[model samples]
Target: MLPPASQFRAQQKRLDQFEALTGIKTTYSYVPYGQLLDKITTEAVGGSSEYDLFSFQDSWMASLVGYLNPLDASIAADKLDMGRYPEVFREACIVGGKTYGLPIRAHPQLLFYRKDLLGEVGAKVPASWSDMVATAGAIQNKSGISGVALDYVKGSGFQNLWLWFNCLWGHGSDLFDAAGQPRFNDAAGVAGTQAYVDVLLKDKVANPGSSQFNEYDMVNSMAQGKSAMIMVWWWTYSVLTGDRSRLKPEQVGFAPMVRFNGGKSPTLATLMPFGISKQSRHKAAAWEYLKWVSNPDLEVEIVCDKSDPQTSDIVATQTATYLNDKVNAVNHGLHRVALESLKGARILPKLTIWPEVASVLETTISEIVAVGKPVKPSLDDAAAQVARIARRSGRHRS
Candidate 1:
């Protein structure tokens, strides 16, 4: 489990009820985000694990699947239909031909903008990247604030790659081809990368400090009224409208992520799923716990709960829950907006060495966006490095 222990704590509160209903006693342990991957992999390699179930990012499936119990039999036995989730979520939990886990948490990108600011400038919500730039520029000219705040800074998690990939996919380009060769240096790829960078340099509508901003910084920029718009994960709506923020709930508006004109619009999605350990002594009990925690009813309850601020979360993994009328009423229809975005969402490449590939992209984006490095040549260098990495790891097309 990652930080923001509040969500886990809330789930912990329901353990007694679960025990009463199913005679299954469960407990959860918290792990820091940075240390979790190593901890899970190390324990697995030692031929034992400290936990019966492992909660992890979807991208880690390639590395951890061998040590995980496939849930296909259990899923069929329990009559659990995986189709209830969106396509991206369903695919994220399956590797090769086996289902590994159930999605517990997921995030789709949304463009969060200031409603009052846009109204004042007579700008409608942007449906494309060009519209966003023009709208952002109009708001900036009128308000004297940066049009948008972006995360161009390098981070341990490679935050910059998250946004850049959306542009890449939007422009009909991808990080690799069907046979797993580097193609991000091709014409469409260079154009996509250039469009993303132009938000900060060419358009000049981006926050001046965006070169150093992380995801949290972009959210803070919205809370403080320093910027007019931010393209971020849907979960941030809770923080942006919470007690600490200066803006009112009515002031913030959200829409699906913008796309390149007439191109594919694929928003990046992050999914967290819990898998049963292959070495666990309590696979049945762990499956019970997984089902209970991921139940759509419980998800709707948590999203609608206003009693505890600590436990309040708007992220929903099930399509039914996102479209539920009750959930939409309380959440300002945020889940509905998220559902629209998830229609064309995409998960990261499920390669075991994605972390390394992300590192290459992070450096390339920083060099081009912050240091004014030439885009095409920098991307060419990155493609070459990635090709070498793939060849050495036996992941290349040849």
Candidate 2:
């Protein structure tokens, strides 16, 4: 089995538990992020690999479809109900009318604020982007700290585009039209990009060095008391309330991602799916292990484990796990809030060339935010670049 570095420890613990419970032995391998995709591709193409199962990001499904074994037969034989997971997650696992993976971990964006700071300044939690900006400015003036922390840095690929996509969706625009042509250069797109840029360049509520910060940097800023609030993934709650953080659990608050006035609230979902490699010699045994590890009961237990006590990583794909009374009671209704957020959640475009498209978009945003390039021209250039790639790939028309 192969797992990424970020999930290695928890996966190791779960594997040990599985081994002890069933008297089965499973070997493990840890792969770093940059080398994971190449490793999977090379091993699968060679038709001889040592690893039986591997974990991958949702966006990679399209590119890796040829090398993965479809899980629909196994799921059917095992009598697992796909309906138990969210529709968006289920859709991500399916490519070309076949199920290739099972969703194990998912992330949705949330607004993490310092509850004590908001109360001290007499400001309510912001419900819209305009309110967020105004509230951030007020909080900054009243207390001498950066109002917000954002992942505005360049070259982070997709980290920058995640929040931008939320702004676009909130404003009733999308990265592409129904015809599969780029449409983010339209009026709503301009407004979304401008609003995001103004947060750092115009309103100045974020730290001056925000252009260098990614998800980790922004979360660390909030944990160290350097920023009053942040918009990031829900998994970071573990860090803010962990032993090393400066704040206590009671001081932090979570809310749905801010929406446009009278607009539906939407956030991006980061999903990690686990699949069995086609070249594995022990496909049947691997399938059994996958079912055991992804069981809803086991997931709930892992999310609410009392031994560590500081971790708040919620279950990714199962709805019942989040709705469980035991999970909600221990998490202070975090599961409930996450469920609400998922109502308007969306996954990234399932195109094989999404990585290239994301790189172009992130660069354009950097030019606008860091180099003072005008918004409309920058976005138009990005749209053109994406359209070129989409046309070349035969996935979309210009």
Candidate 3:
């Protein structure tokens, strides 16, 4: 798990409770995001691992399926309700019709904006991509601040892709087509990419520093009152209105991600699920831990617990938790907004070669956004590279 250390410690505190109830002691390892893929692959290749359970991102699921134990039997025996989570999240935990894990952390993009700034500019919350840009331009002209802040840095795992996914999908384009070939270089994709870059290049409504910004930098721009809006993960509610922010809680507002005109709105969703290691000696105990931690009641308790600063969390994976009355009251109705976003959210292609595909697209997008490269040609080049990767991996379909 990636750190603040405090967040995981809070989870460990709950695991301590699980130990008391089930007599199963638990410990966790924190790996930096960049190192997690290598660590998991190393452990899998070695045929033994120290951890009984593995917590990993959805993108890695296809590659790690062989190393993870299928949980269908356990879920059936326990009558576990996988329906507790949204469909997108549930789909991420399954591979080839087999349940491999349970989702623990999930996030959908939310348009976080300054209510006060929008009101000052007489701009309404944007419901479409064009509306968002117009609102941004209005805010920039009237409020004397960057209308929006976005992540567009060259590296750092291509956080910029998160922002672009909304545009690409909204334009009815996807990373891959029905035949399992790259198609984001198609006409719709080129148009979507053009619109995405226009904010910084043509319209000039984005924060100037965004050319070099990552996710943290974009969020910080909002917290420090340098930008009027940002489309970020739901978990950012705390940071945008917490002690570090320059604005008050009342001044911040949340909305669903914008869509293309007359097109579907699809926010890119993220899932972090825990899978039992196939080689684990205590698969049953690990399953018990998974059940205990994923309980909707426990998720609500964690989100509403303001007593422990380290353990307090706002992200919820279950529908019931998001709709909880008490949870909304505590977290400013963020869960309600999140539920709406997740209903139409999009997950990445379930491919073992996603890391490689992602790297190619990241570099292509970075060059286009940072160095003023042509969009269509760059996307075409990336598509060719991705096709080669798919072919080499023997995962290409037709």
Off by over 4 Å in 2: 1-8, 16-24, 261-263, 309-312
The TM-score values for the models, in the order shown, are 0.97, 0.94, 0.96
Model 2, range 152-181, lDDT digits (tens) per residue? 777764688888988888777898998998
Q: Which candidate is the best by TM-score?
A: 1
Superior candidate under lDDT, 2 versus 3: 3
lDDT (Cα, tens digit) per residue for candidate 3, span 248-278: 9999999987777553667789988889998
Whose lDDT is higher: candidate 1's or candidate 2's? Answer: 1
Off by over 4 Å in 1: 1-5
lDDT of prediction 2 = 0.82
Task: After superposing candidate 3 on the true structure, give the runs of residues whose Cα lies further than 4 Å from its correct spot.
Answer: 1-7, 261-263
Supply the TM-score for candidate 1.
Answer: 0.97
- Number of the top candidate by lDDT? 1
lDDT values for all models: 0.88, 0.82, 0.86
